[model samples]
Target: LGNTIVFPYSYKSSYKSNLLGSSTSPIQDVNMEEEFELKDGDVVTEVVDGIPTIIFFDQVHKYIERRMAKTIIMKLLGRSIGFNVLLKKITSLWCPRSPIQLMDLENDYYLIRFNSEDDYNKVVFGGPWVIFGQYLTVRLWSKDFSTSQSKVDTQLVWVRLPGLPEGFYSDFLIRAIGQLLGQVVKLDAHTNSARKGRFARLVVLIDLKKPLMSKIKINGRIQRIKYKSLPIICFSVWHVWT
Candidate 1:
């Protein structure tokens, strides 16, 4: 393996096989010494009990994915917060050797995975994890883990262009917003039915070069910007569990 990705929620294995013997999956035992010839860099599988078990012999670390959690759902509730910052905080506490993978189901809700069950326990049961002072609810994931990673998109900050003047085309709107709110990585426009067909009520999705506060200037006037998540919690200490 290039580098071992450690997950606290991983399964422990026995000498007879590299997989957990008590796992719910059906597996059959095999006699590696007599069944077949093994080498340093080959992959083989045998039914143990009723479940299929794979063994990579001396190089199991390189070929097997042992650092991920299946059926281990970690639902989170800090979407109105910065994704990168939140990810950094959680990773710093868990400190997994492999790149941590997370999926943004929608809004601030996310599905996070750890390298081991211990890390999951630490985060879920470690008590009162407050990120940016917003209480984080951690729990076991119940959904399928095979969701394609491509569903992940940029964590966008939605800005309400309340007073956009008439004739504000896409180019001009993007330029105007960029000048006020900082650089825009990606810009998109949407119309709401609640606006009653008024162009001034359009919403713009902005992927900022950096995160910003809740206020910005538009047409030289300070305007409060609404985002997908604007929690009422105040900033507080960031607790770590290492």
Candidate 2:
């Protein structure tokens, strides 16, 4: 339903028809290597309208888990926010030539499909990313992604801290937090004057050499870190094998 925020995996088709379009044509089955094959590069091709069509190249969808609406709203405002906000943010990315398919699995994960490979690449390669005031942790969705070890050398982690004590901004504090967590990528701080004194807010996006499941508390205030993702593998295959 249009109003539903979460649903079981079986609902994907019906949901797609209503929200995206009714373009679920079936592809003829094709054979794959009897044994599992490790492939290089991230893209696949299909024959559509007598032309070769390039697709996401990756079998699974990649997205930012910590940037999802529910988890982010809970971590930042400490409450659940409406799904419409998330939809609006995603749709605003661009006006597409064809409807882009999006589904929030409610596992702090989302899946997106674009009609054009160009649009998909723009999203995948574009930099300086943020969603609803939080830094995004992007990844490809796959069963093996979570456990893959040959990922890029550095992965950026987004963090937000509220209710900092007055005059708490200092290099020492930033470096200390990074040391406690991972390498520092970017830092953001906002200061506002209050009747009593000035209070400050801080946000940090760090580069993690590896995935860490640690939490940090600064001056009794717990900071929510938004950096966790699965492994990514790239390969090019025929659509019939999808």
Top lDDT hit? 1
- Which ten residues in a row are the worst by lDDT in model 1? 25-34
Clashing pairs in 2: 43-57, 44-57, 61-141, 62-139, 62-140, 145-231
lDDT of 1 at 79: 39
- In every candidate, how many clashes are there? 24, 6
lDDT of 2 at 223: 61
Report the C-alpha displacement of residue 30, candidate 2, in angstroms: 21
Worst 10 residues of 2 by lDDT: 25-34
Local accuracy of candidate 1 as per-residue lDDT tens digits, 1-242: 01111122232233243233333312221111113335745778889999999866544442222333431333344336554555667777656554334544444455554534565545544444557665454434432333343222122233455545445536556456655554343334343223322432322322222354456665677755554432232224212211
Question: All candidates' TM-scores?
Answer: 0.29, 0.32
lDDT of 2 by residue, 50-93 (tens): 99897653422332232221121111111233455655565565
- For model 1 the TM-score comes to 0.29
